[model samples]
Target chain A: MTILSFNNIEKHDGHTIVFPSFQLSIESGEIVGLMTSINVRTVLLEMLRRKIPVPDQAIAIDGKSIQQLGKSYHQRVGILSIDDGLYERLTVKESLLFYHRLFDSKLPIDGILQLTQLEAKRNVRISKLTFSEKRRVHYAQLLLSDPDIYILEEADQNVDLETKRVLMKVVQELQKNNKAVFVLTSNMDSALAVTNTIYRLDEHGLHKLDVMQQEMEPEDEAVEEEPIVQPVRFEKIPTKVNEKIILFDPPEIDYIESSEGSSQLYIKGDMYQSMFTLNELEQRLLPYGFYRCHRSYIVNLQKVREVITWTRNSYSLVLHDQSSIPLSKTKMAELKEMLGLK
Target chain B: MTFSLKRTLAIFQKDYKDVSKNMYVSFTVIVPLLMAFLYGMQGDMGVDMVYTVINMSLSLVGAYIQCSLIAEEKEKNTLRGLMLSPASTLEILAGKSLLTFVTTILVIVFSAMIIDYQPENIVIVGVAIALSTLFYIGLGTILGLVTKSVMEASVVIMPFFFLFTFGSYATLLAERFPVLKAAEYMPNTQLIELAKEVQTGAGFGDIWSYLAVICVWIAAVFILSYVTFKKRMMD
Candidate 1:
């Protein structure tokens, strides 16, 4: 059995703290969702990769410190990050073969291909595959390794609904094998869809969020016909500007950018510091037409005046104020469809 | 951690397959043979030209191939996958170096054959070439670690290539400018000097210092490259 724990883990970037005294434990057959803010998700992933040394055996795997497990720890833990680190030139079969050889595993290639639904794509070079197909290839590598613990870092982002379904199926299979899975994501809906136990990470530490009991019950036929509408709340966001606290209407803000681990809100030709992270702000302001266009910038869709094509794959969003924000290449088509731009 | 030959060989096999499909790597191999053929056509394939070709093939071409391969992995972000694998650092390093070493040795030997150059003591020349190959491969790995992309690697490695391969002739100016004497300690310079010693039927005892110097250079370069690589991996 595998047991992964974080006991009072603290991580700081210079003077600002990312994770402050967080404690959690995950065991085999359990899938835990770590709801991370957008600003700190990348930092958290980097910390996890380094396996930051925890005091008093705070972080342990299988009753042993990861440091003690040494190089062998990697064999037991598989990581699937947003990058999907894959060799683009190699065909799907060759890529899988290379990883199989690395682990020296006797697992059959056919089994992995079937599990990932990539049997037809086995001969295609990874460069020619779609984004979703590439993600499945990453999943195939994970399934082939069959690690005891799987770390999914923003696995559902930039992927289509079908791909998300396939990934959830893989997670279920992993759970059936009694493997521990830790999912770090900013999307609460996606996180709640996979795991009942959710931990919200914030300034104080990780807090358990109570899953709504209504979600567990089957909807009545009458209720299905008349869906209940959620009340829209447009709260004034509190921001800091030059040590002064200010409350600004959410709709007035043009966008928010993460600068030096803090969110900067652009409003009315001025910038103000926001205490809420980009992830928190995104969730709060999403109802007001705010969309996360890039890793660092969240643009107010209503404020976008034009979409400029910088290159065949690169794009930038120009706001009404003449300020520009980067648009992710993968999100371009979706943005165009949303804007009704043919 | 125990060193696993099986894992190392697996990496070597994969790298061989990958390199075979890479046009840049293929060109690196052919460039040296082309140079050798040109020299053979001129019918002036003397010991000086032979040593120069060996040095160029092992140091210049070896560094280019090794650096580009590693940098390409970094560009594609696949190095992190390898680093996060169960393979130990030694296994990965040895595996990568083994491919470069074998390819470089084959090129060196083939170039020599084309030039009809035969050393008086084959064993001595082989040892020198082997040590030189290790040194150049180490240098290449260092270059790869320091470069962020394959384009940057190609640009950054040019100075080192010229400095090492052409720097041996600095000995000609050593008589007039004593400052140039330090160039004799460079790996390529030692390789050329050792090759000359072997051509004149020098034994192990006669060229032991040159061998020692080359080995020291290799060790120093390997240590530096390993330290930088580990640092980059962690970051």
Candidate 2:
């Protein structure tokens, strides 16, 4: 079931447009990530939190308008902001129990603690817990609320790796329970870590980011094994933005992602679309120290900073700026050999 | 908005543990008891002094503690968490106020014991005190809603504390300054007046006027707090 839906959300800050007619719908058993700048995220969050009604029945919970829902909208949509907001004096168990009762949740206290992985520190005061532990307590509170739709704001930000993994697991668990999850984060990498249905919202409006890397193909590895060395037709990769073709040096490009068949070149943090296909770009840029890290992604080798092994088959290449690109298992072995690492 | 005693008690229980551990707020609860002890040593304290200690307890524990609790929640942003919970506004407010209420009543009882206050009608005095506590809690709620942090709450609450707690004494200057006469209508002053009337064998009928004033204060403060809370909900 579709738990939350909003459309035609237009907001103007004086003469400037904050959001020029935006819309989104989150269904049960789905996790959607909306990645944007901090300013855009703040505006989007304000709209969601205040339920500022717009024309054409824009915001709704289970198809009912926010106005009709009134304050009950909060009961159906739970948001976890960046701040943990746990009482420093209250123990983890005490805090979760308090929210449990407030939410009228029948879920056992120990069950929530175990889900948040805070059972060992159940009796410890929030003040004594580490920063990540406090974040877990906050997640525990939201879990106990058990809203139909969960909107998390930068849940993985500024936490330890363990906490990030714990949050990812919790999101997966929520999805399994048929709860719709919408994550709003400024970091693309964090959004990718959580879910693949990612969208970027900005002044230009909302655009879905092609974050899901195509599954590895057996024949693609053979193609990579034999590099087709060709003369570099042009060192400048051409991309179009505002109808202006901006030529970028091969080294200047951080990565090229093909989403829904069109190639997008990411330089610094900005995105520009290229006219070339991913396969063509891969063949053209291979001599310029670019590698096909994933079926949908071609990354500049100089920009690859670290190789993160998430699981036996899952890997990601962390760029210098901390942005990540998916690395297939076979490609990982090839990249390791290219770096002369046995 | 449905009210749930179970949810309210859950909040009260959480606050009970929270307040006990928060030394900055718990220390304010002791101020009235210490004052009562000092007054008890004086032997045969006057009615004004006895009411002064009781009013101090109401203002300090009732208003100050409630304000700090709400302000701290706002400071840490937990108030938003609670507001978004399934609990109703009344439940959250009542649960939070219940803690301050229990602490204020306990202090009032202990202070009465220490000062050996024997009123003509305990029932009437208790009613006045109870109404006045509601008034203070409302004041605290408004104060907590207006301020963003616990430190800001502490600073913003000082003027209200002095006005409500010492507004009764300010009435003595009414002859010299007629503007000060308005202070006589403060709930704290009405509580003191009702206590004095009870000491003189005044029945509930005779003291209903004083109770009316405190009730008005409660109604006004509660209405204002509700408005402020609604405004702050989005802020």
Candidate 3:
């Protein structure tokens, strides 16, 4: 059994901090969901791939520092991103065989082919395979390596319902095999469905959510002794503006503007000072069609009118109110998916 | 394990299979042999032509093959999978280099056979060609790391190929222009000079300095390529 721990880990890109002193631990037979913004996810994956130096006692696997493990550390960790990094010319069998040989793995090829249900497409070139088939091939390749830790980024994106089921089944199998799985995804429903534990990664650090308690709060609180029915609770976020506190319904807020470590809520032509940090507000409002489109702005998806591509790398979200909000280039695809554009 | 020769051989075989399917890479391997055949037909199979053929084989074909193989990986984004694998950087480098090295030697040997060029000392000529091949492969790797696509790699490698191979001809103009003599110190020039010494029956002791110069060039290029590759991989 392997255990991976992050003890007060801090990561930064130059002066801008990405992960700020977060502590997390995952052991075998558990699936952990890490929900992070698109930009932070990109930077985090890059750091993990490069094996950037970590502070002493910050990160450890199996009770040993990752830095001290050297190349052997990768042997225990497997990563699967949206780009599976497959060679189009290579057939499914040949691709798996190549990785198997490169890793000097003892796992049998037939077992992997069977596990991924790719036995019928063994001889088919990756280019000829469907996107789901290619994804399965990537899972098969990862199975050949048989790592103790699996990190999957955006595993559910652009996949059909059936493919998502197959992926979830694979995740279950990995858990049964005593593998620790960490999934980073923007799809909250899928994450909530498969993962036993959920954590939100914001500017402050990693915050674990009590999934069961949050889900049961409504029903449990409504069980009063009286026969009278309780009114449905509409969640309201309180904000302070000019020494006065205003209760604003979350759905009514068009966007939140963050500057100088403070935030302001824009609700129907009115601005109010926000008591919470942008990170905290993002977590509280993400389920309500709000997306952290940029570092300083979180726009409600219902209010977004059009997406404007100013350049190849620059993008802006035109809201219904004719106000433009900056969108991260890396988050464009996800935003499109969220908007059902493609 | 940091590296394994068996794993490296496995990667080499995979590369061979991949290259066979790529028409452009296959054509690159054939170009040098075609040049050698043309030189043989024209009766220009002298020591100078032999050096030029060897230079073309190493710098032109070698650079294209190595650069394309790597750039294609980056284009396909499979290098990241390899990097994330248990295989060490040394194993990947050695594995990829093995195919380039073997194919290069085969092209050079076939070219030499077609030209009917005979060296007084076969060992010295082989060493010189091997060292030159290593140096060119290192340079090719650097080009591959910096290029974003196979087309970019081809465009970037062309000017360097000409400057290293055809640029040696500048030594012939050294008497008229003193600054042109500096071309003699180029890696390809040193390789040609070493090959000429072998043709004139020079022993190991007589050509030690030339060998040293080529070795230094090999060391410098290899170090630079490795550094660049590591940095690019991180980025």
Candidate closest to the true structure, highest TM-score: 2
Question: What lDDT is reached at residue B59 by model 1?
Answer: 65
B55-79 in candidate 2: lDDT tens per residue? Answer: 8888888988888888888888787
The C-alpha RMSD of each candidate to the native structure, in angstroms, is 12.4, 11.2, 11.4
Q: Tens-digit lDDT track for model 2 on A243-326?
A: 234466788789999999799999767787898999999988999999998999999999989999999999999998789999
- Top lDDT prediction, candidate number: 2
Query: What is the per-residue lDDT of model 3 for residues A207-228, given as tens digits with 9 covering 90 to 100?
Result: 6654442232356545665587
Per-residue lDDT tens digits for candidate 1, residues A90-147, read: 8999989988888877789998888778899999998899999999999888777778
Q: Which one wins by TM-score: 1 or 2?
A: 2
Q: What's candidate 1's DockQ score?
A: 0.48
| Best first by TM-score, ranked | 2, 1, 3
Each prediction's Cα lDDT score?
A: 0.82, 0.84, 0.82
DockQ of each: 0.48, 0.62, 0.50
Q: TM-scores of all models? A: 0.76, 0.79, 0.76
Off by over 4 Å in 2: A212-265, A268-342, B175-179, B230-234
Lowest lDDT sum, 10 consecutive residues, model 2 chain B, at B79-88
Q: List, in order, the clash count of every candidate structure.
A: 0, 0, 0
lDDT of 3 by residue, B1-235 (tens): 6458877887888888888878877888888899899989998566888878889999877777888888988898888888777777778778888889988999999999998888999998888889888998898889989998998998998898788769889999999999988899998898888888887788999999998999999899989997897798665
